[model samples]
Target chain A: GAGVSQSPRYKVAKRGQDVALRCDPISGHVSLFWYQQALGQGPEFLTYFQNEAQLDKSGLPSDRFFAERPEGSVSTLKIQRTQQEDSAVYLCASSLGAIIRSKNIQYFGAGTRLSVL
Target chain B: DQQVKQNSPSLSVQEGRISILNCDYTNSMFDYFLWYKKYPAEGPTFLISISSIKDKNEDGRFTVFLNKSAKHLSLHIVPSQPGDSAVYFCAAQHNAGGTSYGKLTFGQGTILTVHP
Candidate 1:
Protein backbone atom coordinates (compact mmCIF):
# COMPACT_ATOMS: atom_id res chain seq x y z
CA GLY A 1 0.00 0.00 0.00
CA ALA A 2 3.01 2.26 0.20
CA GLY A 3 4.08 4.40 -2.72
CA VAL A 4 7.52 4.74 -4.25
CA SER A 5 9.78 6.64 -1.89
CA GLN A 6 13.19 8.33 -1.94
CA SER A 7 15.57 9.20 0.90
CA PRO A 8 17.40 12.33 2.00
CA ARG A 9 14.56 14.51 0.70
CA TYR A 10 17.15 17.25 0.47
CA LYS A 11 20.88 17.00 -0.07
CA VAL A 12 23.47 19.73 -0.18
CA ALA A 13 26.83 18.76 -1.59
CA LYS A 14 29.99 20.67 -2.37
CA ARG A 15 31.44 20.74 -5.82
CA GLY A 16 33.62 17.69 -6.59
CA GLN A 17 32.01 15.69 -3.81
CA ASP A 18 30.19 12.41 -4.25
CA VAL A 19 26.52 11.96 -3.36
CA ALA A 20 24.26 8.98 -3.18
CA LEU A 21 20.43 9.02 -3.49
CA ARG A 22 18.29 6.08 -2.63
CA CYS A 23 14.95 4.81 -3.93
CA ASP A 24 12.66 2.14 -2.59
CA PRO A 25 10.13 0.92 -5.11
CA ILE A 26 6.86 -0.76 -4.30
CA SER A 27 6.95 -4.37 -3.27
CA GLY A 28 7.34 -6.85 -6.12
CA HIS A 29 7.81 -4.12 -8.67
CA VAL A 30 10.14 -5.54 -11.33
CA SER A 31 10.89 -2.29 -13.12
CA LEU A 32 12.75 0.66 -11.65
CA PHE A 33 13.90 3.91 -13.28
CA TRP A 34 15.81 7.07 -12.44
CA TYR A 35 15.43 10.51 -13.90
CA GLN A 36 16.88 13.99 -13.47
CA GLN A 37 14.88 17.21 -13.72
CA ALA A 38 16.39 20.63 -13.92
CA LEU A 39 14.34 23.59 -12.81
CA GLY A 40 11.40 24.34 -15.09
CA GLN A 41 12.28 21.33 -17.21
CA GLY A 42 10.71 17.92 -17.56
CA PRO A 43 12.21 14.88 -15.98
CA GLU A 44 14.85 13.27 -18.19
CA PHE A 45 15.62 9.60 -18.29
CA LEU A 46 18.80 8.54 -16.46
CA THR A 47 18.78 4.76 -16.25
CA TYR A 48 16.56 1.71 -15.89
CA PHE A 49 16.71 -1.64 -14.20
CA GLN A 50 14.64 -4.77 -14.31
CA ASN A 51 15.15 -6.47 -11.03
CA GLU A 52 18.93 -6.57 -10.39
CA ALA A 53 19.92 -6.21 -14.03
CA GLN A 54 20.32 -2.78 -15.57
CA LEU A 55 18.54 -2.62 -18.89
CA ASP A 56 19.72 0.79 -19.93
CA LYS A 57 22.07 3.56 -18.82
CA SER A 58 22.21 5.59 -21.97
CA GLY A 59 20.54 8.53 -20.29
CA LEU A 60 23.32 9.04 -17.78
CA PRO A 61 24.64 12.53 -18.50
CA SER A 62 28.26 11.46 -18.09
CA ASP A 63 30.53 8.87 -16.59
CA ARG A 64 30.34 10.48 -13.16
CA PHE A 65 26.80 9.32 -12.74
CA PHE A 66 26.16 5.72 -11.79
CA ALA A 67 23.21 3.67 -10.50
CA GLU A 68 22.67 0.17 -9.23
CA ARG A 69 19.84 -2.13 -8.08
CA PRO A 70 21.58 -4.99 -6.37
CA GLU A 71 18.70 -6.74 -4.55
CA GLY A 72 16.19 -5.77 -7.27
CA SER A 73 13.78 -3.67 -5.20
CA VAL A 74 15.95 -0.85 -3.89
CA SER A 75 17.99 1.37 -6.25
CA THR A 76 20.69 3.94 -5.74
CA LEU A 77 21.99 6.74 -7.94
CA LYS A 78 25.47 8.01 -7.31
CA ILE A 79 26.92 11.21 -8.63
CA GLN A 80 30.65 11.60 -8.24
CA ARG A 81 32.63 14.82 -8.48
CA THR A 82 29.46 16.82 -8.51
CA GLN A 83 29.34 20.11 -10.30
CA GLN A 84 26.99 23.07 -10.16
CA GLU A 85 25.52 21.82 -13.37
CA ASP A 86 24.60 18.58 -11.61
CA SER A 87 22.16 20.30 -9.28
CA ALA A 88 18.64 19.10 -9.85
CA VAL A 89 15.86 16.92 -8.50
CA TYR A 90 16.45 13.21 -8.90
CA LEU A 91 13.26 11.20 -9.39
CA CYS A 92 12.62 7.49 -9.12
CA ALA A 93 9.74 5.51 -10.57
CA SER A 94 8.57 1.92 -10.68
CA SER A 95 5.86 -0.19 -12.19
CA LEU A 96 4.84 -3.78 -12.58
CA GLY A 97 6.10 -5.59 -15.69
CA ALA A 98 2.68 -4.76 -17.16
CA ILE A 99 4.08 -1.49 -18.44
CA ILE A 100 6.32 -3.57 -20.65
CA ARG A 101 3.68 -5.85 -22.05
CA SER A 102 1.35 -2.90 -22.48
CA LYS A 103 0.80 0.62 -21.30
CA ASN A 104 0.94 0.84 -17.50
CA ILE A 105 1.28 3.84 -15.26
CA GLN A 106 4.57 4.55 -13.48
CA TYR A 107 4.36 5.38 -9.80
CA PHE A 108 6.84 8.12 -8.91
CA GLY A 109 8.56 9.13 -5.70
CA ALA A 110 8.70 12.61 -4.19
CA GLY A 111 12.34 12.75 -5.38
CA THR A 112 15.61 13.80 -3.83
CA ARG A 113 16.47 17.43 -4.17
CA LEU A 114 20.24 17.63 -4.74
CA SER A 115 21.96 20.96 -4.65
CA VAL A 116 25.58 21.25 -5.69
CA LEU A 117 27.46 24.24 -4.43
CA ASP B 1 16.17 17.45 -30.67
CA GLN B 2 13.48 17.09 -28.06
CA GLN B 3 11.42 13.97 -28.53
CA VAL B 4 8.44 15.36 -26.63
CA LYS B 5 7.27 18.98 -26.59
CA GLN B 6 4.56 21.01 -24.85
CA ASN B 7 4.57 24.29 -26.71
CA SER B 8 2.25 26.16 -24.39
CA PRO B 9 4.01 27.14 -21.20
CA SER B 10 0.81 28.00 -19.37
CA LEU B 11 -2.94 28.33 -19.70
CA SER B 12 -5.71 29.83 -17.60
CA VAL B 13 -9.34 28.87 -17.89
CA GLN B 14 -12.61 29.25 -16.04
CA GLU B 15 -13.84 26.34 -14.01
CA GLY B 16 -16.38 24.09 -15.77
CA ARG B 17 -14.90 24.83 -19.19
CA ILE B 18 -13.08 22.17 -21.13
CA SER B 19 -9.32 22.17 -20.74
CA ILE B 20 -7.18 20.89 -23.55
CA LEU B 21 -3.45 20.19 -23.27
CA ASN B 22 -1.45 19.24 -26.30
CA CYS B 23 1.83 17.41 -26.81
CA ASP B 24 4.01 16.76 -29.87
CA TYR B 25 6.76 14.26 -30.41
CA THR B 26 9.42 14.25 -33.12
CA ASN B 27 10.35 10.61 -32.66
CA SER B 28 8.15 8.34 -34.70
CA MET B 29 9.24 5.36 -32.68
CA PHE B 30 7.19 6.59 -29.73
CA ASP B 31 3.97 4.64 -29.61
CA TYR B 32 2.83 4.86 -26.02
CA PHE B 33 1.85 8.30 -24.73
CA LEU B 34 0.98 9.37 -21.17
CA TRP B 35 -0.09 12.45 -19.28
CA TYR B 36 0.92 13.35 -15.74
CA LYS B 37 -0.08 16.11 -13.35
CA LYS B 38 1.87 17.57 -10.47
CA TYR B 39 1.37 20.07 -7.70
CA PRO B 40 4.13 21.97 -5.99
CA ALA B 41 6.29 19.91 -3.59
CA GLU B 42 5.19 16.62 -5.09
CA GLY B 43 6.20 14.22 -7.80
CA PRO B 44 4.00 13.82 -10.85
CA THR B 45 0.98 11.54 -10.76
CA PHE B 46 -0.38 9.69 -13.77
CA LEU B 47 -3.46 11.31 -15.32
CA ILE B 48 -4.19 9.50 -18.56
CA SER B 49 -2.55 7.50 -21.34
CA ILE B 50 -3.15 6.63 -24.96
CA SER B 51 -1.41 3.94 -26.98
CA SER B 52 -0.75 4.22 -30.70
CA ILE B 53 -3.11 1.39 -31.44
CA LYS B 54 -6.08 3.46 -30.31
CA ASP B 55 -6.98 6.93 -31.51
CA LYS B 56 -8.76 7.80 -28.31
CA ASN B 57 -9.36 6.61 -24.77
CA GLU B 58 -11.68 8.07 -22.19
CA ASP B 59 -11.86 7.69 -18.43
CA GLY B 60 -14.47 9.57 -16.46
CA ARG B 61 -13.58 13.25 -16.75
CA PHE B 62 -10.35 12.75 -18.72
CA THR B 63 -9.83 11.77 -22.33
CA VAL B 64 -6.70 11.28 -24.42
CA PHE B 65 -6.54 11.39 -28.19
CA LEU B 66 -3.61 10.31 -30.32
CA ASN B 67 -2.88 11.22 -33.91
CA LYS B 68 -0.04 9.04 -35.12
CA SER B 69 0.20 10.75 -38.48
CA ALA B 70 0.85 14.05 -36.74
CA LYS B 71 2.90 12.61 -33.90
CA HIS B 72 0.67 14.47 -31.52
CA LEU B 73 -1.52 13.69 -28.53
CA SER B 74 -3.97 15.78 -26.60
CA LEU B 75 -5.59 15.49 -23.19
CA HIS B 76 -9.04 16.92 -22.77
CA ILE B 77 -10.73 17.48 -19.46
CA VAL B 78 -14.42 18.20 -19.47
CA PRO B 79 -15.75 20.60 -16.89
CA SER B 80 -12.36 21.44 -15.53
CA GLN B 81 -12.23 22.17 -11.82
CA PRO B 82 -10.07 24.43 -9.71
CA GLY B 83 -8.50 21.34 -8.25
CA ASP B 84 -7.30 20.42 -11.73
CA SER B 85 -4.86 23.30 -11.73
CA ALA B 86 -1.36 21.92 -11.88
CA VAL B 87 1.62 21.41 -14.14
CA TYR B 88 0.81 18.81 -16.75
CA PHE B 89 3.53 16.76 -18.44
CA CYS B 90 3.28 14.70 -21.58
CA ALA B 91 5.45 11.61 -21.87
CA ALA B 92 6.14 8.94 -24.46
CA GLN B 93 8.11 5.74 -24.90
CA HIS B 94 9.51 4.07 -27.99
CA ASN B 95 8.24 0.66 -26.90
CA ALA B 96 11.35 -1.00 -28.28
CA GLY B 97 11.46 -3.42 -25.37
CA GLY B 98 7.65 -3.75 -25.16
CA THR B 99 7.90 -2.51 -21.55
CA SER B 100 8.43 1.17 -20.89
CA TYR B 101 11.37 1.15 -18.54
CA GLY B 102 14.47 2.91 -19.76
CA LYS B 103 13.33 5.25 -22.50
CA LEU B 104 10.32 7.32 -21.47
CA THR B 105 10.75 10.95 -22.52
CA PHE B 106 8.72 13.83 -21.06
CA GLY B 107 7.70 17.30 -22.17
CA GLN B 108 8.57 20.60 -20.54
CA GLY B 109 5.12 20.73 -18.89
CA THR B 110 2.25 23.22 -19.05
CA ILE B 111 0.94 25.00 -16.01
CA LEU B 112 -2.83 25.20 -15.96
CA THR B 113 -4.79 27.60 -13.81
CA VAL B 114 -8.47 26.83 -13.43
CA HIS B 115 -10.35 29.70 -11.82
CA PRO B 116 -13.52 28.82 -9.99
Candidate 2:
Protein backbone atom coordinates (compact mmCIF):
# COMPACT_ATOMS: atom_id res chain seq x y z
CA GLY A 1 0.00 0.00 0.00
CA ALA A 2 1.07 3.58 -0.55
CA GLY A 3 0.34 4.40 3.08
CA VAL A 4 -0.39 2.66 6.34
CA SER A 5 -3.54 0.52 6.40
CA GLN A 6 -5.52 -0.75 9.39
CA SER A 7 -8.51 -3.01 9.90
CA PRO A 8 -11.19 -3.66 10.85
CA ARG A 9 -12.10 0.00 10.64
CA TYR A 10 -14.46 -0.51 13.57
CA LYS A 11 -14.84 -3.16 16.22
CA VAL A 12 -17.50 -3.79 18.88
CA ALA A 13 -16.52 -6.08 21.72
CA LYS A 14 -18.44 -6.91 24.83
CA ARG A 15 -16.81 -6.51 28.18
CA GLY A 16 -14.64 -9.58 28.92
CA GLN A 17 -14.50 -10.44 25.20
CA ASP A 18 -11.33 -10.39 23.15
CA VAL A 19 -10.52 -8.38 20.03
CA ALA A 20 -7.71 -8.03 17.57
CA LEU A 21 -6.75 -5.07 15.36
CA ARG A 22 -4.50 -5.28 12.36
CA CYS A 23 -2.14 -2.83 10.67
CA ASP A 24 -0.30 -2.90 7.34
CA PRO A 25 2.46 -0.34 7.21
CA ILE A 26 3.88 1.34 4.16
CA SER A 27 5.94 -1.01 2.10
CA GLY A 28 9.51 -1.36 3.36
CA HIS A 29 8.93 0.81 6.39
CA VAL A 30 11.19 -0.55 9.09
CA SER A 31 9.50 0.98 12.11
CA LEU A 32 5.92 0.32 13.20
CA PHE A 33 4.08 1.78 16.17
CA TRP A 34 0.75 1.36 17.95
CA TYR A 35 -1.12 4.05 19.83
CA GLN A 36 -4.36 4.31 21.75
CA GLN A 37 -6.50 7.44 21.57
CA ALA A 38 -9.38 7.91 23.94
CA LEU A 39 -12.27 10.18 23.17
CA GLY A 40 -11.10 13.83 23.17
CA GLN A 41 -7.50 12.83 23.75
CA GLY A 42 -4.42 12.56 21.55
CA PRO A 43 -2.99 9.22 20.59
CA GLU A 44 -0.87 7.62 23.29
CA PHE A 45 1.97 5.28 22.45
CA LEU A 46 1.28 1.62 23.17
CA THR A 47 4.29 -0.09 21.67
CA TYR A 48 6.98 0.13 19.00
CA PHE A 49 8.54 -2.40 16.67
CA GLN A 50 11.74 -2.20 14.71
CA ASN A 51 11.06 -4.70 12.00
CA GLU A 52 10.12 -7.88 13.92
CA ALA A 53 11.70 -6.76 17.19
CA GLN A 54 9.43 -5.37 19.88
CA LEU A 55 11.59 -2.54 21.08
CA ASP A 56 9.27 -0.90 23.57
CA LYS A 57 6.03 -1.83 25.26
CA SER A 58 6.16 0.40 28.30
CA GLY A 59 3.13 2.49 27.41
CA LEU A 60 0.74 -0.45 27.27
CA PRO A 61 -1.77 -0.06 30.11
CA SER A 62 -1.86 -3.70 31.15
CA ASP A 63 -0.62 -7.20 30.50
CA ARG A 64 -3.76 -8.07 28.59
CA PHE A 65 -2.71 -5.78 25.73
CA PHE A 66 -0.36 -7.59 23.39
CA ALA A 67 1.16 -6.66 20.01
CA GLU A 68 3.29 -8.48 17.51
CA ARG A 69 4.87 -7.96 14.11
CA PRO A 70 6.10 -11.40 13.31
CA GLU A 71 7.19 -10.89 9.71
CA GLY A 72 8.37 -7.28 10.10
CA SER A 73 5.48 -6.01 8.04
CA VAL A 74 1.95 -6.74 9.19
CA SER A 75 1.22 -6.14 12.87
CA THR A 76 -1.60 -6.98 15.21
CA LEU A 77 -2.78 -5.65 18.56
CA LYS A 78 -4.83 -8.08 20.59
CA ILE A 79 -6.67 -7.21 23.74
CA GLN A 80 -7.86 -9.98 26.01
CA ARG A 81 -10.81 -9.50 28.37
CA THR A 82 -11.80 -6.11 27.03
CA GLN A 83 -12.98 -3.46 29.43
CA GLN A 84 -14.99 -0.32 28.90
CA GLU A 85 -11.92 1.73 29.61
CA ASP A 86 -10.21 0.02 26.69
CA SER A 87 -12.61 1.55 24.23
CA ALA A 88 -10.68 3.86 21.98
CA VAL A 89 -9.26 4.30 18.50
CA TYR A 90 -6.19 2.21 17.99
CA LEU A 91 -3.82 3.83 15.49
CA CYS A 92 -0.87 2.30 13.70
CA ALA A 93 2.02 4.19 12.16
CA SER A 94 5.11 3.34 10.14
CA SER A 95 8.35 5.11 9.43
CA LEU A 96 11.71 4.69 7.84
CA GLY A 97 13.52 3.46 10.90
CA ALA A 98 16.98 4.64 11.93
CA ILE A 99 17.17 7.06 9.07
CA ILE A 100 18.37 10.45 10.24
CA ARG A 101 16.61 12.20 7.38
CA SER A 102 13.21 10.81 8.32
CA LYS A 103 13.80 11.05 12.08
CA ASN A 104 11.01 8.54 12.66
CA ILE A 105 8.45 10.84 11.12
CA GLN A 106 5.46 8.49 11.14
CA TYR A 107 2.71 7.91 8.62
CA PHE A 108 -0.55 6.72 10.17
CA GLY A 109 -3.56 4.64 9.25
CA ALA A 110 -7.24 5.51 9.59
CA GLY A 111 -7.26 3.46 12.82
CA THR A 112 -9.59 0.88 14.29
CA ARG A 113 -12.37 2.29 16.43
CA LEU A 114 -12.93 -0.20 19.22
CA SER A 115 -16.02 -0.01 21.37
CA VAL A 116 -16.48 -2.13 24.49
CA LEU A 117 -20.04 -2.72 25.56
CA ASP B 1 1.99 12.21 34.24
CA GLN B 2 0.85 14.39 31.36
CA GLN B 3 4.21 15.46 30.06
CA VAL B 4 2.66 17.39 27.20
CA LYS B 5 -0.35 19.65 27.70
CA GLN B 6 -2.57 21.56 25.28
CA ASN B 7 -4.32 24.03 27.53
CA SER B 8 -6.89 25.22 25.03
CA PRO B 9 -9.71 22.81 24.36
CA SER B 10 -10.99 24.75 21.40
CA LEU B 11 -10.26 27.83 19.29
CA SER B 12 -12.40 29.73 16.81
CA VAL B 13 -10.95 31.63 13.88
CA GLN B 14 -12.32 33.39 10.88
CA GLU B 15 -11.28 32.35 7.44
CA GLY B 16 -8.22 34.24 6.18
CA ARG B 17 -7.21 35.04 9.74
CA ILE B 18 -4.38 33.43 11.67
CA SER B 19 -4.92 30.60 14.11
CA ILE B 20 -2.53 29.86 16.92
CA LEU B 21 -2.47 26.82 19.22
CA ASN B 22 -0.24 26.35 22.21
CA CYS B 23 1.30 23.33 23.97
CA ASP B 24 3.56 22.92 26.97
CA TYR B 25 5.65 20.03 28.19
CA THR B 26 7.31 19.25 31.52
CA ASN B 27 10.00 16.99 30.17
CA SER B 28 13.05 18.98 29.24
CA MET B 29 14.56 15.96 27.57
CA PHE B 30 12.28 16.34 24.53
CA ASP B 31 14.40 17.34 21.57
CA TYR B 32 11.97 16.94 18.74
CA PHE B 33 8.49 18.50 18.46
CA LEU B 34 5.78 17.92 15.86
CA TRP B 35 2.23 18.97 15.06
CA TYR B 36 -0.49 16.72 13.68
CA LYS B 37 -3.95 17.45 12.29
CA LYS B 38 -6.79 15.00 12.45
CA TYR B 39 -10.39 14.72 11.37
CA PRO B 40 -13.04 12.65 13.07
CA ALA B 41 -12.72 8.93 12.29
CA GLU B 42 -9.27 9.40 10.82
CA GLY B 43 -5.77 9.28 12.17
CA PRO B 44 -3.59 12.32 12.51
CA THR B 45 -1.54 13.65 9.63
CA PHE B 46 1.86 15.15 10.13
CA LEU B 47 1.95 18.94 9.87
CA ILE B 48 5.43 20.24 10.61
CA SER B 49 8.21 19.57 13.04
CA ILE B 50 10.91 21.57 14.78
CA SER B 51 14.02 20.29 16.46
CA SER B 52 15.23 21.73 19.74
CA ILE B 53 18.34 23.06 18.03
CA LYS B 54 16.21 25.66 16.27
CA ASP B 55 13.33 27.68 17.63
CA LYS B 56 11.25 27.88 14.49
CA ASN B 57 10.24 25.95 11.39
CA GLU B 58 7.86 26.77 8.61
CA ASP B 59 6.05 24.89 5.86
CA GLY B 60 3.52 26.44 3.52
CA ARG B 61 1.15 28.55 5.64
CA PHE B 62 1.93 26.66 8.87
CA THR B 63 4.69 27.63 11.25
CA VAL B 64 5.86 26.10 14.48
CA PHE B 65 7.63 28.02 17.24
CA LEU B 66 9.39 26.37 20.12
CA ASN B 67 10.62 27.92 23.37
CA LYS B 68 12.89 25.51 25.11
CA SER B 69 13.31 27.73 28.12
CA ALA B 70 9.58 27.68 28.93
CA LYS B 71 9.00 24.16 27.64
CA HIS B 72 6.38 25.55 25.28
CA LEU B 73 5.66 25.16 21.59
CA SER B 74 3.00 26.62 19.34
CA LEU B 75 1.58 26.23 15.83
CA HIS B 76 0.43 29.13 13.72
CA ILE B 77 -1.71 28.86 10.63
CA VAL B 78 -2.05 31.95 8.48
CA PRO B 79 -5.23 32.45 6.48
CA SER B 80 -7.02 29.64 8.20
CA GLN B 81 -9.30 27.54 6.02
CA PRO B 82 -12.46 25.71 6.93
CA GLY B 83 -10.89 22.50 5.67
CA ASP B 84 -8.19 23.00 8.26
CA SER B 85 -10.67 22.85 11.07
CA ALA B 86 -10.02 19.72 13.08
CA VAL B 87 -8.21 18.45 16.16
CA TYR B 88 -4.59 19.47 16.34
CA PHE B 89 -2.12 17.71 18.57
CA CYS B 90 1.45 18.44 19.57
CA ALA B 91 3.92 15.62 20.06
CA ALA B 92 7.43 15.37 21.43
CA GLN B 93 10.21 12.82 21.14
CA HIS B 94 13.45 12.35 22.99
CA ASN B 95 16.43 10.12 22.31
CA ALA B 96 16.61 7.65 25.17
CA GLY B 97 20.27 6.89 24.52
CA GLY B 98 19.40 3.87 22.42
CA THR B 99 17.14 2.63 19.61
CA SER B 100 14.05 3.23 21.70
CA TYR B 101 14.08 6.92 20.82
CA GLY B 102 11.28 6.45 18.28
CA LYS B 103 8.64 6.73 20.99
CA LEU B 104 6.52 9.89 20.90
CA THR B 105 4.53 11.57 23.68
CA PHE B 106 1.50 13.54 22.58
CA GLY B 107 -0.65 16.31 24.05
CA GLN B 108 -4.36 16.06 24.71
CA GLY B 109 -5.21 18.09 21.56
CA THR B 110 -7.01 21.31 20.60
CA ILE B 111 -10.06 21.58 18.41
CA LEU B 112 -9.86 24.39 15.88
CA THR B 113 -12.79 25.74 13.94
CA VAL B 114 -12.34 28.15 11.06
CA HIS B 115 -15.56 29.76 9.99
CA PRO B 116 -15.98 31.70 6.84
Among the numbered candidates, top TM-score falls to 2
Give residue A101's lDDT in candidate 2 (0 to 100): 29
Worst lDDT window (10 residues) for model 2 chain B? B95-104
Cα-lDDT of candidate 2: 0.93
Candidate 2 segments whose C-alpha is farther than 4 A from its true place: A101-103
lDDT of 1 by residue, B7-106 (tens): 9999999999999999999998887888999998788999888778999999999999999999889999998999999999999977676334436799
Superposition TM-score, candidate 1 onto the true structure: 0.96
Candidate chain B TM-scores, in order = 0.95, 0.97
Q: Can you tell me which runs of candidate 1 are displaced by over 4 Å?
A: A99-103, B98-102
Clashing pairs in 1: A100-B98, A100-B99
Q: Write the per-residue lDDT of candidate 2 for residues B43-112, one digit (tens) a residue.
A: 8999999999999999999999999999999999998999999999999999775556778899999999
lDDT (0-100) at residue B103 of candidate 2?
Answer: 81
RMSD of each: 1.6, 1.0
Give the candidate number with the greatest lDDT. 2
Q: Give the share of true interchain contacts found in each model.
A: 0.64, 0.78
